[model samples]
Target chain A: MEVVLMDILGAVVTFLVAFVVGMTYGGLSRKITARVQNRKGPPFYQNFIDAFKLGSKKSAIHHGVMHHFGPAFLMVSSVMTLMIVPVLTHNQWFPNLNFQGDLIFLLYVMTFGPLGMALGAGQTGNPNSAIGVTRGLSQMVGFEIPWVLALVALMIQYHTTSITGLMAAQAHSGTWLMFSSPFAFVAAVMAMFGMFRYSPFDIVGAPTELASGPISENGGKYLFVMMSSGSVFTFAKLTLYVDLFMGGADNLLILLIKTFALYLIPVLYGVTTPRYRTEQAVRWFWGWPSFFGLLAILQAVFF
Target chain B: MMNDKNSQKIVDIIQNWARKHSIWVLAYGTGCGAIEIPPTMTSRYDAERLGVRGAATPRQADVLLITGYLTVKTMKRVIRVYEQMQDPKYVIGFGSCTINGGMYYDSYNTIKVLDKYLPVDVYINGCMPRPEAVLSGFAQLQKRIAEGRANGAQQYKDNLEWYRANQKKIIPNWIMPDYNW
Candidate 1:
């Protein structure tokens, strides 16, 4: 009984911390995005207010009964992402979960909310949203491959699937994994940055091509929940990336600050660049990032 | 001195809070002019500083900041959204679309002037205004709201005929889809 209670308490605390941290990261990214564009930006509290208002708005039903599931699933997927991410601490039970897996687990698990959103949008039969959904998922397929190769190379160097272990090893070794495998790091960063879907790669719900993308049909509170979840998910993904690369998760504040730095890097990329077509993003990810990621793997092994 | 300072601080906070909440806008995004919205919300324009946001649903938005000219079809949706919005929402005609139909005035599917359809709180005169123009327009509208001079949505609800006639002209056989005309 006591063990069960402790486990429940840990899970609750973990979730609460991730929720607050994830929301903060999401909020700060919005501000960073404004700064990159030479704008003063919204208050950090804006996202929370938006989310609260969205969740409070009178529901506007769309199409069918199943349409209701999209926002619910999106919220669940976002919270689950915070739960799985070892961004806060490695002192998590089932840290290895199934196998003592590495970045591969992170990669696959991270895809769920997006995939679920895309599928849910397609099911609604809104041609615009369906097109956006199709494009977003297809873009994911292209980016994920090179991202996996980059992860594999890092795993080879560290020889463990544990993200926390990899960071600890790098911290003790006195040189960041980024220094040892700069090429892979750069390739992965670019690929993942594109995956962040800020600009250039914002083809899925290309406002020009298809209204507002998959959730374009969603309105009132429903759209709000999905968008807020997406923001939270974006922060979680960035947090995971920073924790893995920067070895900054030794303390919560350090982890947060490093994540902020990592988040800013991508937002800066977003502001300065123009959006890419879906085909353009896929080609760039598979073509250039893949090539660089491969070269880095060879260099890491043979050198 | 401390009591006076505390009271002053309380007053300042309340005023700030009120200013942030009541920014009503003209919700028209007439054409391709709507493309600038992402940058306005994103890190670039960062309208959050002004507490301005794009409300997907009409009821939650205080400002209906119209972007550009209105097509007949999009005009229908715009009217629907405007009707749904609560009172105290301000309408800022973004570009020439609301001022005089701009380029779309003589176009087959465009309305000649948006004011014929809805009350305008402020007219931002530009062919297609920049984010700066839009933001400034919002600031002007906010100033009016602060002084309690603007409450256009309620006025709109009371005088529906002027707007209805314009809408009826567009949708000649105007009846809810469920109702047989």
Candidate 2:
């Protein structure tokens, strides 16, 4: 009974930390983007207010049961991924559920929310939502090739499928995987661009063209749920990358700093670049990023 | 005194506060006055700093910005869009054209008074209100929302028959689906 209670408490703590941190970082990214564009941005807590306001709005029409419950489905997937990804390197405080999953599992789990979201968007009866979903699924296929290759290379090289084992190996070697296997890190970061769905690669939900894309029809509490889930998912994906490449962090502050540093790669890149057509984005991912993934594999095999 | 009614009032106060701070305007710009929106939203005026951002659809929007002169043909579409929006919504009748059709008052199609078909929560009266005027208009709307006086949506619901009658009187060929929402 006591063990079960402790586990529940730990899980709640992990979720709260991830939620608060994730949303704050999301707001900060908006602030950063605003500053880069020569505009004074909204406060870092603006997203919180937006979410709460959206939540308070009265519920309106829905297409069907699938559309009505889509946000709930997406949230479940998001929380599942967060539960699986370890936040800190080796800490009792962060008690992540990494013990239950490996890299392969995390790779597959990340897609669950998008699939659920796509279904919800499809049910909205909006043509733009359909177009957005198609672009997103296609982009996923394009980026996953190189991303999977990079992950497979690291797994083969480290001789462990588990994230904790990989981190333990890094601790023993006294070097981050980023420095040891520069090619894999390069490929992964490039993949992260597409994964982050920033500009250039942001053809999926092209806001200007598709009117906010998949979630175009989503609003009020539905949008609020989507925003909260998105923040949590963002933190999970970033933490996974940090754990996989930057050798993870020993403390909360270090974790945040390292994750934010890792986050800047996509964000700043997005700010300066123009949008890409879906096919162009797909081609871009399959071209240089795939080549780097191949090189990383060769390096792992030979060295 | 601290009963369910009191608690409901407290909830309304909190809800009103949240609604006032975060007003998502639908990106549907009606007519020539739409041109003024870009400056208000962009770096020059920066409306986002005040928690006013553009929403992609009516479902997500709290404020419907009727930029200017809504013609009889466009009024059908505007009414449809207005119906699609969720509750607690407000409409801003932009420019003198929306209030009394301005120079377009003599024109056959231009809607002379926008409030006849839909409630205008705030009206920024000018042929083309500058970005500063637009920003102040939004601030005024926010102030109204905070004071819990901006119940235009509720007003529309309460007098739905009258509003619908007025709307149908102008739109003789009303072929769009029922304004059920």
Candidate 3:
């Protein structure tokens, strides 16, 4: 009972932290976007404030009973995603959560929230939203297989699924996983980055084409909850990368540097690329590097 | 019995105060005025010092700050969300969208005025109001609340017909968009 209660508490705290951190990125993106367009943007807390205000308002049940559960379902999955991910060392909230097995677990757990959202969007019966969710899901189907294959290679090479354990192995060998098998690392990094819906892959929520995509129907409180979830998911993924490739650093400063360096890759890529059509993203997901990802598997196995 | 009454009274007082000070704003970024909300609430203007926070759940919010214009589609969902919020709530329409239609004034979908659909506590005027304008609107709202002049939830309840009528005028199809279908 005590452990269960602590887990809930930990989840809540992590959720809040993720929300704030994620919004900071959103604010940062907005600023970056404005600079690109030669405009002065609002402060970073803009997304935060927007989400908070909307979440607090009275939740109206629009589109009937199923819509009522949409926000609740998304919120649950988001918090659960935090629970499954290894956020802290010494395992602050969930002691059972290990870095190794948790990575694979993280992949599966994260899948549902988006699926639920796509379903909810379909329920809205708006052709645009339905089309958005369909495109988002189709994109998901194409990339997820290659992404999983890449992860499988990582697991086979390291001989562990625990994120912390993988990092520990690297520390002992005086090498990072990215160095051992650059292709796998690249493929994994790209897949994860694409998963974030940052440029080129932002088809699911394409404001231009789909009007905020699956969440087109959401407004006020519902919209805030969704944005809050997006925020926490970002931090969680960033932290996951840190654990996977750059853990075992002694002090906070080195860890921060490594983490930020890892994050910059995604940010730079996001800022530079134009949006990819659904078909093009799938082709990229399945075509070129994904084929090399198999060679990465062979390299990890034979070497 | 006395303690219960006192507790009830205390609860009422706190709720009333929360309703006023911590007005969580949902400035849906559908227009230019959406940009002004951040400065009005962040460090330079610091709306937080007044207890106003941007919340993520409707159950936790007391006020909905609709920053600017709403299209027919956006207004439909906005009305639905507004209805979900608990009573004793207030709505503040920032910039010309809430007052009149502003730039989208002649647009077919944009509501010429917000009060036509929802009860508005304050009407902030600016083509796209600046942070200062939003702050002034917040002050005006606070004043009205303090003076017992603002009765949003009560008015909404006591005059259901009026509320219904107002929403009907703005939301072309007073029927809530069925997202569940």
lDDT of 3 by residue, B1-181 (tens): 6569888777556544544554655555677776787777555676654555564433334677887888878887777766656544678888887787888878987888788677888888888778888778888987887665778766666676776776676566565643321
Fnat, model 2, is 0.75
Relative to the real complex, the DockQ score for model 1 comes to: 0.20
List, residue by residue over A1-303, the lDDT tens digit for candidate 1: 977776677766655566666667666777876776677877777666556544544453456765777777777777666555675555643132223674666676777777777767877787888888888888988888778878888878777876767777877898777787887787788777667787778887566567667876575567667766776677567666775676646667787778777777767777688888778888888898889889878876777
Evaluated on the second chain alone, the candidates' TM-scores are 0.79, 0.95, 0.81
Candidate 3, lDDT over the whole model: 0.70
Candidate 2 lDDT, A63-167, residue by residue in tens: 888887778878888888888778886666567666524688888778878888889888988999999999999999888988988988898898888888888
Cα lDDT computed for each candidate against the true fold: 0.69, 0.87, 0.70
Sort every candidate by DockQ, greatest first.
2, 1, 3
Candidate No. with top lDDT: 2
Misplaced by over 4 Å in model 1 are A90-99, A168-175, A299-303, B1-48, B53-63, B66-77, B80-166, B175-181
Cα error, candidate 1, residue A223 (Å): 3.3
Q: What TM-score against the true fold does each predicted structure earn?
A: 0.74, 0.97, 0.68
Q: Give fnat of each prediction, in order.
A: 0.25, 0.75, 0.05
For model 2, the docking class works out as medium
Off by over 4 Å in 2: A99-101, B1-3, B179-181
Report per-candidate DockQ: 0.20, 0.76, 0.10
